[model samples]
Target: MVQESFEFVVYMIHACATKWNRLPSFVYRKLAESGCIQKFLVPNYEILHTQSTDFVVSDIEEYLNVRKVAI
Candidate 1:
């Protein structure tokens, strides 16, 4: 449940980024402080070799779907 909520927030962040071309600095800082920047967005590059904002959003969506199925 908690994970799902977190992923939803991450998805929203990426969705905003995709629309804006980049996340605002303040928003990015807040997300970084919350650890989402490191845990979800960063690790994706290590595993997939791509960290484009669109890819990040897709990754979060995929993760959320997988978690939903697990439930």
Candidate 2:
């Protein structure tokens, strides 16, 4: 089951945000805190303990900066 539309949306968003950088984190935190969005977003183990593709320390710092907070 390939999702071309979903992938296109993600890629377009990421590409446009590369210069802005903080957009993803804003989205991530909002999604992470919400039941519906979080279900489709990154999982807890990877977000908290692993530095895989999208959930790394740099990403955390970027996200914190957007919220004007730190971890």
Candidate 3:
């Protein structure tokens, strides 16, 4: 389930980038550096050996909030 959520987020990011004619890797790196992506995965590293779904969801929500503020 966690993997599925991660994949879904990745796919959405890629799709949005592609729609905007941006490079997915570049966008992904930018998001990562901004703490908008992938950072949540570390929180549950010990327990799940992967990111917790809850953490990932919260991270995404926080990312959206940040984006809303920036815009």
Could you estimate the TM-score for every candidate? 0.36, 0.29, 0.47
Residue 38 displacement (Å), model 1: 2.0
Compose the digit string of candidate 2's lDDT tens values, residues 1-71: 13543453354335434634658665444434543123332333333333343443445446446656532
The better candidate by lDDT, 1 or 3, is: 3
Better of 2 and 3 by lDDT: 3
* Candidate 1 clashes between residue pairs 3 or more apart in a chain or in different chains: none
Residue pairs with backbone atoms closer than 3 Å in model 2 (clashes): none
Clashes (backbone N, CA, C under 3 Å), per candidate, total 0, 0, 0
lDDT of 3 at 20: 44
Whole-model lDDT, model 1 = 0.54
lDDT of each: 0.54, 0.42, 0.54
Ranking by lDDT: 3, 1, 2
Q: What is the C-alpha RMSD of each candidate to the true structure, in Å?
A: 10.0, 12.5, 6.9
Q: Give me the displacement of residue 66 in model 1, in angstroms.
A: 13
Model 3, span 1-71: residue lDDT tens:
37765766576456546654678876566567666645543343344335455554445546656766221
Candidate 1 lDDT over 1-71, as tens digits, reads 35644565555575756654765564455456655556665554445433465665566556545545210
Which candidate comes out best when scored by TM-score? 3
Q: Give the runs in model 3 whose Cα sits over 4 Å from its true position.
A: 39-71
